[model samples]
Target: MRRGFKTEAKTLALELRAEIGLDAYSPFDPYAFAAEYGIAVVQLSDLDGPARHHFLKADGSALSGALIPNGTGVVILENDAQPLTRRRTTMCHELAHVVLEHEFGVSLSDERKCGLSGDQEAEADWLSGEVLIPSDGAFRLARANATDEQAADAYDVSLAIARWRMNHSGARKVMQRARAKWA
Candidate 1:
């Protein structure tokens, strides 16, 4: 990411949430967000083939999701066989790539390798986290002293993702520092 990328992502996430009639405090729906952007979302089960089987497997090695750029739009294919929470994260991840306007390079190779540069991928991952649980939402959760599982349930995200957002977003640390200062 660049100097201003994180700030930009935070603003975009909150704005997009508002555009969908959701406040920064509400859970985000990637499917609705994708429809708003006119991006298509398809499930891997909707496909039929050996590749689908490979990608749909519940194993840890299975593909999470993929983004394909169309002429002026994009489509997201997610591994629906996974848990719903995992699917949601994957959808947002693919949407993040589109939202970031990342120039594609194959996206998926013959060996199922992602073509995005590491930086681009990292940027997308961070941006997707913002989209799923905006900084404002995370901050509110932290202020309430919400647990990771509570945040996950509230945001409809996985426990790991919720914990990552809560920990890395600095919301908890900020609140802790504020409490200590006032105490």
Candidate 2:
């Protein structure tokens, strides 16, 4: 990702936070936020191929605003059938896609084994992490030397997400140091 574009994406996220009453370090429920913004929430067990793989999509190729077709103004989220936290993260990822207007055809990475490849996906994941587990919460938990499960419980997020947040927020070194000291 280009530095300019990355900054732009962060700016967009900040703008969205202000627009939707989310602060710099406040946790926001993606599902409820979507509902407030008129984004539709869908949970179907078995969807078709494209629907299942895409996770979410707009009416056509335009990925700037809500995914609602016509005048519905609804954002659609495909459930992964995981826990509520996972579902919320997925929805937040989709919302990031919309806000970022990620390029539809560009490939972020060139790994055949990896399914979701793109700079867009990475950005979306970062955005979702910021939204769900804000910096303050993550920093507090990290400073407390919280376990993975404890952090997850505190943040109301999944273990995987908690770990990722820790890693992304530059807590990996802190965690390593704590583990070594305890060991």
Candidate 3:
């Protein structure tokens, strides 16, 4: 990711949240956001045969979601068989790619073009995380002494994702530092 990319992503995520009549602390709805952007979100259950089995019921499926671009607009294919939290994260990730307008070649059937590799993929991942749980929201949860499960429930995200954001997002560390300073 670029140096200022995270900062930009945070701003954009907040703005997007506000656009959907939500605050930074509120849970993000990727489906609604996709609708707002005029992007079609289709579930993998909509597919039949091999495609459905590959993404939904396959063992160790590397694919979580995909963004398919067409001549007029793009559509997001979400693996609905995954858990609710996972489905949300995947939707946000696919939407992030569309929002970033990253260029890509034709997508392969396998895991070859699973969101286009390298920087674009990284950017989409980071932006998706931010959209799912803003850093500011993480900090607030930390300050409130919220546990990973609490954060997950509050944000409608997975506990793993909540823990990752609380730890990796520097929210807990910042809260600890603040407590030390006040103490």
lDDT of each: 0.79, 0.59, 0.79
TM-score for each predicted model, relative to the true structure: 0.87, 0.63, 0.88
Task: Name the regions of candidate 2 deviating beyond 4 angstroms.
Answer: 4-27, 45-74, 103-116, 172-183
Q: Give the TM-score of candidate 2.
A: 0.63
Ranking by lDDT: 1, 3, 2
lDDT of 2 by residue, 1-183 (tens): 455654465556656766777765555567666766766766544557675545443542212112334343434535445557756666677666656665332211111111244565677767767766666566677777778888778767778888887777666676678778999
lDDT of 1 by residue, 58-138 (tens): 654556677766777777877777788878887777777787788642233211125576777778778888888899999
Specify the poorest-scoring 10-residue window by lDDT in model 3.
104-113
Show where candidate 1 strays beyond 4 Å.
50-61, 105-115
Model 3 off-target regions past 4 Å? 50-62, 104-115
**Candidate 1 clash figure, as a count:** 0
